[model samples]
Target chain A: MSLIDSISRPRAVRLPRIDGLIQWIVPLAIIAIWQLASVTGFVPTRVLPAPSDVVLSGWKLLLSGELVRNIWVSFWRASIGFLIGGSIGFAFGLANGLSQLSAKLTDTTLQMVRNVPHLALIPLVILWFGIDESAKLFLVALGVFFPIYLNTLHGIRTVDPQLIEMGRIYGMTDGELFRRVIFPGALPSIFVGIRFALGIMWLTLIVAETIAASSGLGYMAMQAREFMLIDVVVLSILIYALLGKLADSASRVLERLTLSWHPAFQKR
Target chain B: MQTALRTALPETELASQANFAPHARVVREERLAQTSGLPLTIRGLRKSFGDNEVLRGIDLHIPAGQFVAIVGKSGCGKSTLLRLIAGLDKIDAGSISFGQDVKPEDIRVMFQEPRLLPWARVLANVEVGLGRDRASQDADARAERALTEVGLADKRHQWPSVLSGGQKQRVALARALVSRPRVLALDEPLGALDALTRISMQRLLERVWRDQGFTAILVTHDVAEAVALADRVLVIEEGRIAHDVVVHAGRPRARGSVELAGLESSILSHLLSADDRT
Candidate 1:
């Protein structure tokens, strides 16, 4: 049959559990081996804590609610910065993508600005906004802005011309054309931008907090490092990893919700 | 509100008051036993993309409400001609003069790709053809009627991704017809479908055109489709009309009928003859 004739063809594979287990087996085995080595005293405890030791530290932190408090601070700051910077970037990116005059005027300036490291603005941000919440937020926002802007612009520009023409022919106004044809068409790329920006926001927050901060997971880690409380340092790192994973998983859920109707996500 | 604006509705509305009632001002014409509703006149319409000339000194007239198919090899400017008529492409010179009071919104087009918004349900895709304001105000009601017209009322909530190629095209057709455009232009809308699907879509298109009485201009390279769906087929050669054939076969045409096949063969022969001359 031709490819077109196979539109309704039945899927052949059915080993969904096998596919799931295939990914988990190696990671679980590695963790088990590490725990076994620690128990056997193959390595010194000072160098690497057993998984059980880390779990104990985690439990203590959790009981005191210190872990949650620190994490909450980091999460809130990242979210606020992401929302502000991302919105601004999204608007500018869309303008650049849609109009030739805007693209011509802004493309060069955007590229030049994007090349400058956002982290370098730390001292200046601190000087301008002080070593307060605003300074840390400004740093995080600057770090996130470029990825969202660049990806959103790319997404908008790549929307199919044929679809835009289809909208015009159907008596769609400019606003309707953008909403119905352009926005949904650019969604997959826009999600990519959101994901990238979220990752950067976390990274920037860590650096910004490590430099100067009274509360947050990054501040705790920096304080722990000074006293050589390696367990606390490891504990803080673990917390950061868990928090990042949670944020990423939430974003993935958002992506699936928005893009379930996309062709790429449809079941064969 | 003014008293006239708040006046009570009439008990029995006349046909003239209904939205679908054909306008009386339209002067219908006949060519080769087929009805032609209006004339699209273009005088010296010229366009060029930088150094490359796409349409050079083009002048043509298409009778209104007639099913006219434009056929040409790729880059022969057949699609360009359709775009210009639909007002999608701007002309560098001259002007496209429509029949009196011809509004820009009265033209609709169906493209080769289904081009349905992935986020939109099948019904919403159909409703996209309704102007943005209308689609926004009464989206659910308008989408329902359009989906019902396309025999897909049950699939109103179904995503476009789940649709088969033929069903997607059906949604696209529903979108084109929902707004009741006076002129419908199709650019190989059925070309991407399987042969069987294309045949069925051709019949569906013909039925809609006859029932709705909308003028259609189809741009295609398939001789069979040109003969089957069009009232008059214009074979464009070198950016100009070379042969214009009036297909005499009546509407509700069977896909593999001997009469339909004969007309298809005649067009094929004409295309070959033109090819030889070129």
Candidate 2:
């Protein structure tokens, strides 16, 4: 959490305490104005509740314990889906990248499936998995797979041929060449895929939870919408935005840790 | 260069040796072939990329511990010949033999680009040249000594990206030298450096070759560099050895000395006329 803060307020760009406070002024003012408008009836509470009302509803949910439980459930689903899809995609990428036979066997079919939007398969997914947790997990996994697969393949393929040649001339076996040279060379591209997969992971989870999920942020939003509890719905959206930002920041930290030797990531 | 020889011999011998200094260096080189470097012989070597024959019917023999420089026009097959000698590429016909069994680590090539693994630090990059022995106990010490030889020991912990162009090339040299190769094939290794850096690097190359006694095969376009450092300069034209020039310049020949300048001009003219023909 502190690392994420440091990235947002980088030491090079961050100013003194007074200026640091100034960075938050615009958002605070917007919230204040929003509260004023709700009190003065400029906007109907039914359509869009005030930020304070959303906070109150969030507090109520926290006391009742649904907020923590639902958040955990959503986080768990995304983690499991991301892991399953990311690993399989990486395996396929290594297979195709290293072996011409594997590429010729599976590349055409993968490209064909990649053309069909994964979200479009939601109806068929529902029919196949019957609108349960499996349906949501499958959708999330399918949505995240293609980006990781394509990027990992490209990353491996695009590694500098000269470096590979150097490795060969230095007496590196095929396995050592991949481990010492090719994989590190491909990591920057792989990180790009991870970030893309994260986006798709969240998008899939959002849609998946709405399909009869008994627990999760998306299900909470759906239940609140039916009851016209606008504040709860707004709170759930805010929570998602926060979670997505956190996930992205976490990945960026991982990227920096792994690729610090890269020119772009090295400390100034 | 003179101080060591002068101290080793008496002042009377030094004065008498001035006239035959070049031959004295040659005699010393003959002694350097005690078994460190392997002598190479090639017979009717031929290589082609499709229909365009790169090296046609090449025949040559190089003694162990001899510093040879090959000069040519861009497509004159000097690099192709070097690649064949190093076994980086296959020959279409004929043979290149080291005259003995040579291990995988016995021959190494340093290309124009540093080709250091950017993901690896300077020391790790140098360690790569040790072949299968990179995991041995003495690998780190050997790599460090090679870096110290190239005068970049201070930069061993840094990434290759952070080094200057000349420094990166030095690191590459260290990597090539760490393996203690019997044959070192240099494919225009200093072609990208600035003039001053190139000259300094040349001096370093000469010093290391003298100390380690590797069979150095340098492929370069600079005739001045060829004459100053090499015992023999081979000019390639029409995919064959067009001129075999022997330089008798003594150790540490002064830049632009009369003897070296004459050899450089003659080789440059050969290269330019080859260009004119094309």
Candidate 3:
């Protein structure tokens, strides 16, 4: 008999999935009330436009292709910045975590640099790159770097020593030990870093875009604010919320895929 | 603590700790059955962590396929000796030579913790034991054979996290066995297991030892467990083997039998009396 068949799968109780819309009730009600109030002029339109007005602004931007372009720009900035910063941080973490000499050489300097608020350097960053793409990239990368680096380093350091000893005793080579034991052991913590960095990634992009930029969602919002297009401004805020949620969900999906064996992830 | 364990309960009480059939098919391979164990020659083995000497000149010889157990109080350096023997800790002032020029996989250690990789499925965790041969064509077959030997063939696809504590330790045993190790150093492997699980594991350990004929060196705190499994029991006091007791009993010795219990009682009393003296 195939052993795989005997694993006794936990069948989650199924419901027809109009069941999912139960969670949407409050949000829909709020949206309805806000739209009603906005249309009847219960609240001044200039201060906070109706949800429909914001949706109209989004439609206008979408038809003109401005929405897609800005979304693409923001996505590109966030991802590229994440990749560059994340890789560098990962490399440094590996080097430092695995070697006393490397740790001694650079960890103190990195820690000192980490203490200074990354956003506080926005003024100097603007002066350095002057509204160019590099300023935003720099800010985003810098914002993304510390969390990943710290988490990666902490992850590597806290990996169970007994497991390492067992690996060596079982005849694992240095590379094999790292691949089969060290990396997997540190992965949960590393994922923590990824989730944290993703948040920082968008936060940095939004701030950088809003402060100085020719393109991106932040620039779009900034332009709307200048022209007092409150509906567009509100739409940008909603879009930022959506973007943040989207990014977090993507990381969560990746986390679930890799860490399916983790106890916390073993449930339905 | 010693007094409580010294008092042997009824045989049925001891027998209730059985998680497996009394005679499970543990002997998977008979190709090279009897002479698989490597003889160990440890000469004046000394180990110290800085100024504190853990093992002070431990000179001992273990014959091929001998089941030896070392027992001692908390600070008596039993684990230090085992670590030195396993080559996990460096000897400060001596040599430990094996009967043959052994490769890394020839010797294996099973620690108290199962140490199964949580990221790996049960089968992959067992495959980790094949060492350099883990990538070979027959590695999966060998691991499957080992898992079968431990009666855990069916749980191979499950995650390590899902397995019960006893089952996890059994998987660790399968991993250690997958290497076809000539020497298996068990550092209180059953220490973390519950009483029922511990007894079941003890039997599994003995069956595998008899089947594969590996040099088994178990370091433990449980006197009854040591008496139950090991052919020879060595009690350490002040980093030295104070008593080298041999159990002159036949195979498949009954659990909680008077003979075994008497020996366990005497050893525990001696250990306790010594503790009081210190």
Q: Pick the candidate with the highest lDDT.
A: 2
Residue pairs with backbone atoms closer than 3 Å in model 2 (clashes) = none
Deviating ranges (above 4 Å) for candidate 2:
A1-30, B1-35
> In angstroms, what RMSD does candidate 3 have relative to the true structure?
8.4
Report, in order, each candidate's fnat. 0.88, 0.91, 0.88
Question: Which runs of model 1 end up more than 4 angstroms from their true locations?
Answer: A1-29, A63-65, A120-131, A266-268, B1-64, B92-98, B132-142, B254-266
Higher-scoring candidate on DockQ, 1 or 3: 3
Question: For every model shown, what is its TM-score relative to the native structure?
Answer: 0.82, 0.91, 0.89
Write one digit per residue (lDDT tens) for candidate 2, span B173-272.
9999999999999999999999999999999999999888898999998888888889877778877777655677778778889878876876787678
List lDDT for all candidates, in order: 0.76, 0.86, 0.84
User: Pairs clashing in candidate 3?
Assistant: none
Predictions: Cα RMSD each: 10.4, 6.8, 8.4
DockQ of 1: 0.49
lDDT of 2 by residue, A92-178 (tens): 998998899999999999999989988888889878988777887888888888999999999999999999999999999999999
Span of ten consecutive residues with least summed lDDT in model 1 chain A:
A1-10
Best by TM-score: 2
- lDDT of model 1 at residue B253? 63
Top DockQ hit: 2
